[model samples]
Target: MTDAITPHPFAFPDAALEDLRDRLSRTRWPDRETVDDWSQGAPLARMQGLIDYWRDAYDWHAAEARLNALDPSTTRIDGLDIHFLHLRSPEPDAVPLVLTHGWPGSVFEFMQAAPLLADPRAHGGDPRDAFHVVIPSLPGFGLTEKPTETGWTPERTAHAWVELMRRLGYDRFVAQGGDWGYAITNELGGIGAPAVQAVHFNMFPVFETMEAVDAQEERALKRLRDFKENESGYQIEQTQSPQTIGYGLNDSPVGLAAWFYEKYEQWTDHGGDPESLLSRDEMLDNITLYWLTATATSSARIYWQSMANWQEREIEVPVGFTLFPRDIHETSERWVKERYPTLVHYNEAPKGGHFAAWEQPESFTEEVRASFRHTRQPL
Candidate 1:
């Protein structure tokens, strides 16, 4: 294993682009959905529109340039090469922050937010709101090396993150995440990670055990039940047979795009059109990363590795929750407090959804800033 943290510039090769284009062009599309809407999944016409844009308009070179501008790097941690973007703030007393990305998302989700968080002054914010940001692609995702062994659960990833920060010479830091990122950040809080001062989650992972449900809680429970019943087929397959499905996803570009695009549509708050929230290029950028990395199987293995039980776990450090209104379910403050007794901050944004930072970076940034302000250094 190499000890040096080498500077790594992202360059998607020409051959890969050609192969992707060829696959997209020669896509053997399926019959259109029986319904006219996205209830059955992403409609054939919608997917075709995406394919057209991806093939004719999307520019990988421009995306690569944007990525390259970030000063990304890779370092070996636990025998795996972890790729991360480290952006230092101009503020002399800027707090260190490590942001983790989850499934169906990558470090790219935070691309727009990175500069704002790192150098708020440049983006019309006070210097005191600055953070020295570190965005690491999780194991088996994006540029990070896929683990060969079977022990890369959220718990393990939390430990690896601590080491990653320690190696970067940060003895203290805060963590932020949503979706699977939220799970890992919660795990860090659970284990009392030595360097993690406090943690924030947009998608709070608190499950309520209610014997009596009120109107609001009833609605939330209904949404949870709906998710379990209708929207979790992908989870079942990924958790059960990730390698089997990986074959199709790794082999077919359209299949991969549709699979991810469907989630972006359903999971995001875009009035049934994900494109309304995130640009096609942004969506394809993430999907293309998953495709180019051939991480379909490796990334899905995380679900298989950590799908045992959804037992409640205690988080030790101060916790903050940014409640996005259109997220999967709405858990009340009472339910959240049950799990996070140290809950210091809670606010529900009028806009945004599951991918809060990506869809509404400004609101998400403010929530993060307010969430950790009390814990910031020089307090």
Candidate 2:
């Protein structure tokens, strides 16, 4: 862990806002392309429409206010400033649940789920499902500043989360994650940290240790392999040359928008039209976070920091996995149990993708709640 203390509130600086407007006004937009589809890139017309809305219509302050309304806080743990949203349930004795966001995502990903998790009744769920929720921005993403030193791997991230729970006076909590969040939460349990009572994941990576290559995993693995072979160029690029790409992304707003928007369409379960599944405003809000924070480069640091280190370790916690149809590939229960000796639950979703929080919060919440039912302490 970096010897840095926790972070403070991330106020939207006026200077940053002024700079955004200036950039928008002076944007040297690309020439009108003749094509209609996104083959070449963001369709020229759609890009223009979004840019106009972003520059003229969207309210950054309103978004900031919504963020502020969530009861966020910052505290230093193990030398890093950690910014997190802390929503305590009205249920008085709610279970603590730590939710983490993955790369290309920020705490904002939980905008809808935070309140819902904190007060399930408000969302038409049982009060038993209400939870004391903690959603933190990974160090160096969004409001959390990037680590200036080393040892910021996923394992270290788990440590930070443990310390965070400790500071809040919680002895045990349920843990949930997707994408990189899944990796860190797994580490929390794998390390046998008493702070984490159980773990739940929407996105999980399966290795060979799980049951003998079952038919489903064999097929999922084949598809995974194919997906990587054909479309994993971004990982290679991010790991090796993030700064190079960051330069181009940082120089042009549209470049940054296109870079992320492409992934939203390709990696998500949006059928054909992305808007069918996700709101355009939502997509832009996320992209705007990256664009304004200039987090494109720092966010990639996670890839370079942990991608290699994690393949060397295994998570030993009692794990539960819920596979979504739109995910890159599905993991067979046999495979997961093989890799994770303590595996306890396996689930499947009708529809959703890597962005499960945004796409299916109800199912995601219930799955998390169900996975953690075994972890409750005896009164």
Candidate 3:
């Protein structure tokens, strides 16, 4: 039997785009937050600014053309249709790398970086650094189908990625990710799948046990505490009651925009405004993907499914991490080594944040290239 994967082009109809604008134009009003600062949540004025642009100025057709240019396709794995962008490099010896995106992130995050990784020579990098990049939208996230029932955890996703790569005729390859993609990649290596030769992550997981608290570690620890105290309300709501919030997010375009824009503000390296780092178009492109796909509830279910799998596992394969300065939960080298014993490469990027690949595609490509350069020659 053949591994018959289907080619599914990303084509959203004109009516859908019109409907999105209609919803944005008719957004219900919310009173201004009592405090001037963004203490409570997304400020009404800020969301209104975003909505104004989304309703009037944002161009979905241009974004759709870019997405379609990637030549996206789909394959059925474990009874669910998976959406991915597979770009083959000109270099014969190019490494096969599967890149994964997490929540509030779609394949759009890697759109700029994928071609850079695949054809580094064209982008003013060494020909030896080329990679055959495959970027998959997580099961419930983008063009992929949402699970009808439960059990779509990170472990399951890891297995699906392994199979997906194998179906693409890759016997052995490398993996890289951030956010939920981090957990899935770690789990992939931890499962001891011979197909996964080495893995890398921009967002590293920190085990609960602490070793020492140096100045850097102290700052990271404080940030972790701050996240749990102040920034975890969305996490709790999504993990606990995704369906409740999903209703509002599904019904209202502004509600969905506010929900994600808040993270883009807090998580990115930019000033208070997320628009400073990512253009209104870049952000809306992703937000609109979620809107058209109707994945608000489905995407949140991953948190609930993988809540228990948050702890570190013994990943036997070699691993690399490029820690961006502004990312949340900045684990120290020592902390990371404790969990990833076979850590072979680690670098601290001067710029970017949680969405490194999306924010700084060049920096992200350089780090990814460096990480796997040594691991390229067959295992």
Candidate 4:
């Protein structure tokens, strides 16, 4: 692959946008679930409301403008074109930091948090907490070129991140993530890359074999069981045959929206409605990204490539973690320290969930700044 990095300003053709609206208008929705609640999936009324707004009122160009403002760029890495948003801080001492987004999310996840982290002074915080943020769209996700061959696991993605940072002139940097981002960031710390000074996670992967030591651990275990039994249908399908499901998601705009919107509804720290925390436009901005790029299948392939052999490795690099209360899983400090021996920071956020950065940008920004504070001394 070439080492050249070039600007990747993007705008969907008017025809594509019109096609998306036509698809939404022609969607043949399934019958409503018998249950009033979301036990089955996204409620029919909710899906209808989301699609109606998306088709009639949502502004794709506005979202596109916001994304363009983040300095999007692309470079060929590991036989694929990787897309990333590099936001440099005004502070000369700002630390270089890479932030990875997980499945069902894109670089849009960090839109609000990136600016706050990059220029803390402008966000009513100390200038010393500034970061030159880098947000990369994972292989086969977002604008990144979809891989034709297999083996693009989180471990491989972690190494590609080091190369991406190197090309950006950052020999050493910190990293942070949630969901698959956690897996990738964890690999970054474990790969023995001296350039990866530290890592942080909003989601902690707890092994199924670990025994609960206390009330908190017990509750966490229960939640894990619930997730595996009930909330993992999508995981199982995506891991087993992503292509089979991809045909539907890629064909129907409403299908793609419902698939992602269910996660936002179930994962965010909202009451009964996801819009309580995330605006309709905000959620659509991410879901729309998947639709426009036609990455639903390519993104799911990450699960097919990695989930079967997933295992945690001990990370010696200094580590930090912020477990949001409403997240799918929460691990105790004891469990985290066992894997991250040099654990430097740990906090239990009062609110937020799996999509912490997207749902609670201010809190996510503060947590990131605090997590890497100790690692900022001359890299």
Best by the TM-score measure: 4
Candidate lDDT (C-alpha), each: 0.86, 0.77, 0.87, 0.91
- Across 283-302, the per-residue lDDT of candidate 4 in tens digits comes to 99998899989999999998
Candidate 1 per-residue lDDT over residues 234-311, each given as its tens digit: 999999999999999999989999899988987888976789899999998888889899998899888888876534
Q: How much does candidate 2 score in TM-score?
A: 0.90
Superposition TM-score, candidate 4 onto the true structure:
0.98
lDDT of 1: 0.86
What is the C-alpha local distance difference test score of candidate 4? Answer: 0.91
Ranked candidates, highest TM-score first:
4, 3, 1, 2
The alpha-carbon RMSD values of the candidates against the true structure, listed in the order shown, are 1.5, 2.9, 1.4, 1.0
Residues 64-139 of candidate 2: C-alpha lDDT, one tens digit per residue: 7777776667777777678888888898768888899997777877887788888988888888767898888898
TM-score of each: 0.96, 0.90, 0.97, 0.98
Where does candidate 1 have its weakest 10-residue lDDT segment?
204-213
Scored against the true structure, residue 259 in model 4 reaches a CA lDDT of: 91
Clashes of 3: 0
